[model samples]
Target: MSEPPVSYKRHRFPPQIIAHAVWLYFRFPLSLRLVEKLLLERGIVVSYETVRVWAHKFGPDYVRCLRRKKPSRQDIWHLDEVVVTINSEKRYLWRAVDQDGYVLDEIVQIRRDTRAAKRLLERLLCKQGCPPKRMITDKLGSYGAARRKIMPKVEHCQHKGLNNRAENSHVPIRKRERAMQGFRSWSGLQRFVETFPAVRNHVVPPHSHRSAFATHLHRLAAMAEWKSVTLTAA
Candidate 1:
């Protein structure tokens, strides 16, 4: 006999409660304590510590499920990096998004040099399974250097003003930073950055191009997919 696909084994709280807590934490900039208070208002009693545990345990699992369901990324990629502070130390967040604003990948590193650019490119290549048809990025010399070394065949456009899609994507990070004050550790920041975009992509619709009915349908599909993934308790 094999183990069943659905198992909430040894969990006192049922799947719905656990999943809802994790969702509230990632789906918004809410802290664990804030999430606990929100759940308490809903007549569910769970501690902030418990919410933190659920996030660490179930957040990655939900991201994996969402990534599997996302549509194939568009060929043109927009890449950018911004300096971020962690524990008062400087770090760089490198992000890659498709032309359609789909977050293809993200990573954090201590440097914004050629090495860091290479790390981001390697992740994109490994995840996308090929070089993009064209990549647009700010006029970062490191990006150009890394592109030539790692993906010389792909078309690379280095222009500061042409990467608005990638630039605008940083707004959420700024918002979350204010909401949380600031991150305490690089590891935690990396984990959140890696997983948060998956949740965002699952929720944000391209409203400019979608009709009201089409937007509703898109959200329905997103919620259905969320339930399918998070309904399993970790």
Candidate 2:
């Protein structure tokens, strides 16, 4: 049986309006107020708070509906963790991405230890449904320890120079973090990271590009897919 379309029965605005609002908020580094301003420019009167509510309620639904790349045994996984300061407290955001620069998984935790590394590894294994050909990371002992316990057969390369791809993946999050003026709570940061990466992975051009025409086509397809997933097709 086919899955039912997304329900927007109680929303005051149309699905397209709400989905567009949500997309504007996530697809760019725009704040709620900025998104509201952009919508007002379109002659749509909506408050920033309304945009916030729409993004919170509908962002995950869009992520779930969006298509994801299938896991393959030949893939190379790059794993890394970065510290995020939330509400005067420190936390670690662990992320995994494939060789193609597609974000595979992310998790926020209180520690950056072996246990935390193991949890991230476990999540990736469950989500990807297969181990990659090789794992690369900075000289983080926790990752090495976790790899041995989780998948001893997987090739592990520990070198900062070779882990630039994983390290560079943190740049977008940093930009969003600065724009938001830092996150207020751990849960909120977790939720934002989850939704943000999915939208970015879908819309942005691939890490390695071929031509301007190809890039344009890539974005066009991304926008179409976004509309289809968000149930905002015209």
Candidate 3:
């Protein structure tokens, strides 16, 4: 069955404006106030808090409409975790990315152990609908333990040098964390990661060596798709 269209019935602004605001916030590391200022410069007259509300409200709906990475038996999964400081407490943000530099799934947890690794792998399997051809990670024993139990047949490579794809994936989120001055809570961090990575992966092509013209065409297509998925009412 086809999903229902997202309703934008009662808002004062048009769906385009709301979608654009959400896009500016997630598609870049821009702050809420920065988004507000940008809109105001165009005579939109919205507050930062309103942009925040729109992002939290409509971001998930947009994510649901975006195309996800397809499951492939040939895909190589790169799994890694990073420390996030929330309210003076340290939490681990576990993420899995495919070889093409697309984020597959992410989770926030308090522990960095075999159990945590298992949880991430379980979620990945559920989302991707199959185990990958191979899994790569740093010299983390937890990943080895979890892989042995969860995907015993899949090849597992544990080497710091071989896992640069996963490690480099953390850079964007780290920049966003610093730009926002740090996340306040685990739930907030989770929500941010959930929307941010999807938007980034959608607009930013994975190939690093594409020509300027090719990159331009890719972004043009990405913008068109974004407008279609967000139901831009202009």
| Global lDDT scores for all candidate models | 0.83, 0.90, 0.91
Positional deviation of residue 54's Cα in model 3 after best superposition, in angstroms: 0.9
**What lDDT score is found at residue 164 in candidate 1?**
94
Taking all chains together, each candidate's TM-score versus the true structure is 0.91, 0.96, 0.97
**Backbone clash count for every predicted candidate, in the order shown:** 0, 0, 0
Tens digit per residue, CA lDDT, model 3, 1-234: 555667788899989999999999998888888899999999999999999889988998888887766789999999999999877899899999999999998999999999999999999999899899999999989999999999999999999999999999999999888888888778888988888999998998884689999999999989998998889834
Task: Flag regions of model 3 displaced more than 4 Å.
Answer: none
Clashing pairs in 3: none
TM-score ranking of the models: 3, 2, 1
lDDT: the better of candidates 1 and 3? 3
- How far in Å is the alpha carbon of 191 misplaced in model 1? 1.0
Residue 108, candidate 2: how far off, in angstroms?
0.7
Q: Model 2, 223: alpha-carbon shift in Å? A: 0.7
C-alpha lDDT of residue 162 in model 3: 93
Lowest summed lDDT across 10 adjacent residues in model 2 is found at 1-10
The positional error of residue 129 in candidate 1, measured at the CA in angstroms, is 0.6
Which runs of model 1 end up more than 4 angstroms from their true locations? 1-7, 67-74, 232-234
The per-prediction CA RMSD against the true structure, in angstroms, equals 3.0, 1.3, 1.2
- Global CA lDDT computed for model 2: 0.90
